[model samples]
Target: MSIRKVVFPVAGLGTRFLPATKVIPKEMLPVVDKPLMQYAVEEALAAGITDFIFITARGKGVIEDHFDKAYELETELARRGKDDMLERVTDFMPEGTTSIFIRQQEALGLGHAVLCARAAVGNEPFAVVLPDDLIAGNGRNVMQQMVDVYDRQQGSVVAVERVPKDQTDRYGIVETGELQERVAPLTSIVEKPKPAAAPSNLAVVGRYILTPRIFELLQNTRTGAGNEIQLTDAISALLAEESIYSYEFDGTRYDCGNKLGYLQATLNYGIRHAEVGEAFREYLDGWNNSRDS
Candidate 1:
């Protein structure tokens, strides 16, 4: 089946972004002109996903509002004859794509957040994209790449990247079986294993195309590390029954959840904008030269 629905877990308190995030949802943080979540939504849209299941929290009402039509803004823009800007702003969601919102009252864990969308996902396979992990590439979106693998293999798939061995403890490390270029068939997954005990350097990123069986696994998943229901645990359980594929995406992934990665993504996207690239490049050049001096 074609991947038509995507689940976005936007319930985290974003503790990393203190004061500012105290009021605003971290996913609402501006990347350039648009919020970070907008990028993820756009990426999913590009991958042909027509349904959105946002597992949001209390402060995440702004996210739903962001995608909704703003009558006041539209009227003001139309009165001012600002059709171009209005079109740009209002064209976020395409027609015929269904968007559903569900509240994940408690901030349990990624697995729990996903399970909250079980009703919407039903028994079909669905995609999950973490807005915190902003990925950019020349061609396919990361989830789209995984979906292609799922189409062929008819099972679960996850996006993986090779992290340093020393950093294995920071991510869900996977043991490899058959290697198909950047795509690897998974044998098993170990959540945050020590560097010396890491199965392989391939660490799971935030993108996943999961089967409905995951919801069943998550329903019974016991709280593991950090006293939270981890998605990795459920995924490990799924691995025991089904074949899972991992694809090393050809793209730049920015962990917007981290301060440094957020800044890096801001600069990278800013420097690539047609309207700002030249000016931003010159400013960076001057700044670098001054720092060196």
Candidate 2:
């Protein structure tokens, strides 16, 4: 079956970004000019996903507003003959795309946020995208690459990247059976294991293409690390029922969940932005020269 629906679990508190995220969602934070959420949505859209299910919480109404039409803003821009600005605001969301926002009442873990979209996702293979992981694809995006693996494996596919062994505690570590180029069959998955206990350095990132059976497993899954439901646990259980493949996606992923990563993403994207790339480069060069002097 063709993967058409995508679930975005955006209900987290984003405590790392505190103060700023107090009002605005972390996903709404901009990298260069575009919001992180927009990038994730564009990636999914490129993968031909039509239904967007956002499992959001309170104060995330801005997210809904961002994707929805800004009537007054559009009208003012149109009246002022700001054709480019008007089009930019109005064209953010594509036609024929269905966006459904469901409130995740509590601050549950990733598994719970995904389970909240059970009704919207129904019983089909769907992709889960976390906007915090801003991936820049060389040609094909991360989600599209995972979908390709899903097409061949026809079970579940998760995106993995080799993190430093010491950083294994920060990610869901995957143990692979054998290396088949970029794709590997997962032998086991451990969530946030210590450096000494980590099975392998292949850490799972935020992109996932999962079958509907995951919802059932998540429902049965008890609280694990941090006393919150973990998606890694459910994916572990899924290994018994079906085969799951881990694809080492080809891309540079910016971990936008923290201040350092956010700044790095901004710098990287600003340097490559179409409108301001050259100017930014010149400014950086002058700044570097002044510092050296």
Pick the lDDT winner: 2
Tell me which residue pairs clash in candidate 1: none
- Against the true structure, what is each candidate's TM-score? 0.97, 0.98
lDDT of 2 by residue, 188-264 (tens): 99999999999999999999999999999999999999888999999999999999999998899999999999999
Candidate 1, superposed: residue stretches over 4 Å from native? none
Query: Candidate 1 on 1-293: residue-level lDDT in tens?
Result: 88999999999999999998998999999988778999999989988899999999898898999999999999999999999989978999989998999999887889899999999999899999999999996587777777778888898888998888899998998887877867778899978899999888899999999989999999999998778899999999999888888888889999899899999999999998888888999999999999999
The Cα local distance difference test for each model comes to: 0.91, 0.93
Model 2 is weakest, by summed lDDT over 10 consecutive residues, at 85-94
Error of 2 at 254 (Å): 0.5
Cα deviation at 98, candidate 2, in Å, is 0.4
Flag clash pairs in model 2. Answer: none
